[model samples]
Target: MALFAVLSGLSACGLPRSGPTKGEIRAGSVEEQGDTFIVPVTAQVARATAMVPPLGFTNGFLGAGVIGSDVIRPGDVLGLTIWENVDNGLLAGPGMNSTALQEMQVDGDGFIFVPYAGRIQAAGNTPEALRRIITEKLDAQTPDPQVTVARIAGDGATVSVMGGVGGQGVYPIERPTRTLSAMLAKAGGVIIEPEIAQIVVTRGHHTGRVWLKDLYSNPQFDVALRPGDVILVEKDQRNFTAIGATGAQNRVHFETQELSAIEAIAQVGGLSTNAADPTGVFVLRDEDPATANTVLGRTDLIGPQRVAYVLDLTEPSGLFNARDFMIRDGDTVYVTEAPYTRWQKLLGALTGAAGSANSLSKAAGN
Candidate 1:
């Protein structure tokens, strides 16, 4: 009876569990585990995941305009010329005589003075419009007067560029709508060692931004700049940490564009084959309580928005979930030991010791 009891105790079946069972893991935990855990990604969960907190202006909402003809502005010098046919000319005889070309600067008030056309608002009006105005004024004195208004020098239509560029200064807006790439190139192009990804364009109260390379590759994203727009090129700083069973435990830098959970894991060299718990992949993120409360139902458990998101790699769909899930900055990706890992190890050790004891008892009886 004693030998039979010993043998029964050493059996591998019905191992003691010190952690959550498979059923508990599948059903999902709402028992105050301190995470905004959502199972099966229901409608509410989908809504929250889809939500992107407004960052002042929407993505790609900068001053992206199509390029067009340039407009005259204040401080611009204009070459005004007037010609007369001399038929009904009150200023000249029957012979053809053209007035000397006059170069005048647009005043502070955006007005330019002409021989016949009194100070006309040239800053807000296009060159062609100002030419017509000059022709109309000259018509009173000179019959069939021909007037031409050309921009000699641009004075005020400019954009200020700073930060990580070869040339940083007030470069004139060359076109009616100057593209971001054109503006950057006019400012002597970006520095060799500069951050080519994060570029910012601020126009009055509204601002728009896009990757420098993306602007070049996709002309649509390379938005046009307004007169007073400021372009700031800066480096990226957001990074995430991978701990517990991952090959590398150090923090890894994120890409300028959106980064997903699966990509982040790959950056840290992925989970350990022998130490990782495929079912316990947890993404601990610092979420805003007010925002999390609105998105996720339970905010009473952990007030600060520090929520753990579970990813079960054991399931085939878990990898797909991770691939679609975006990872925010300052997040922690942790993989726990398997639930049955400890129990199996303990059982092997106990069985080995039992076999040793039984062998010793038989030797003593011999």
Candidate 2:
């Protein structure tokens, strides 16, 4: 009797209820629990759902390029300079010097006022192209004219870098810094944490995010930067908690925007060989309440829109199903302990206690 009591105590302390009861794992309802939906692990079940997480670098964000042909636009200021070997007329007229400097601003109609050239169109041409236009216009009047145009100041070629960057300021989107990666480097990369996986890029009315981990592997997302584009490099503050018979019972930080269930399981060190039940591995997720019924295919379910997915790793195809199942940011993985493990704890406890009690009894008798 003393041995039995000691064994029970040790069993309870060691095994400590690895997870929910078998019946609870097998039978649970959205209506009863107020939000838990039960999903079985199967290829069809995993295939039924479609999620476009911000993971791959080649998503819709790369489909489009910079705005308006990347051409010059209004609000741009250009500094125009002209050189003449011999002064003739217009730019370098009779009494003028060999060089003429003019500061021009692109007006609302995408035109710039050039001396003697009248309202010339500068908004849609490159600096070199604009120089040629001006030089050509003065070809007959001026003798051997050379012209240069520089973007002195403009909002159309500048981008704003904010959030998780060393230089959180506006930088020009010059030819060398026209791509996302170029701007990131010029801004001193991510300051808060370069390890972050997502960078939010907003251009005009459309806003999208990219996974930096994928970007490092894929160059497609290193898209050309556009005027008015805002780049935000934020920390990868997403995580999921792992508990129960799995190796670790702590919050696992996200390394990428999307994480496969199997990846998450592997990160937590897989299941505990001694205690984990191959069939009792589960993931708890809180789905959107409004679409849970239709999405989960359980009209009978009623509760708080939380769902649990049971993965039976015993089957050969179980790993495939888990691979396809994407884990959300805050899901929890639980691997219930096997029934035999519980029994072993009890038996071992009883054996040690029994030996101690037997020795005590012998000592008293002596």
| Pairs of residues at least 3 apart in sequence or in different chains that clash in candidate 2 | 7-349, 7-350, 30-302, 31-302, 34-303, 34-304, 35-303, 35-304, 35-305
Tens-place lDDT per residue, model 2, 1-366, is 886676667755754576675557656765465445677768876665436345543345677565443367787767777777664545565777555465467888889877666678988888878888888887777677788888753665778888887788877666667788888888987665445647888877777776666566778878877778889888777889998889899999976556888898899898888888888888887765444665676566455566787888889899899999878778888888888887786886666678999999999999
* Per-residue C-alpha lDDT of model 1 across residues 1-366, encoded as one tens digit per residue: 875465456533454433344345445544545334433432344346544332223444543555443677777777776678765454444564665555587889898777556767888777788888888887877678887777653456667889878888766675533777877887777773433256788878867665666666665667656667788876555788887777788888876456777888888888777767877777766666664676566556445655567777657677777777777778887766664565565657577788999999999999
Q: Pick the candidate with the highest TM-score.
A: 2
* Model 2 CA deviation exceeding 4 Å by range: 1-21, 24-35, 50-147, 152-156, 161-169, 174-199, 203-206, 211-226, 233-238, 254-258, 289-291, 294-296, 299-304, 351-366
lDDT of each: 0.66, 0.74
Candidate 1 segments whose C-alpha is farther than 4 A from its true place: 1-30, 33-155, 164-166, 188-196, 212-223, 235-237, 287-305, 337-366
What is the TM-score of candidate 1?
Answer: 0.53
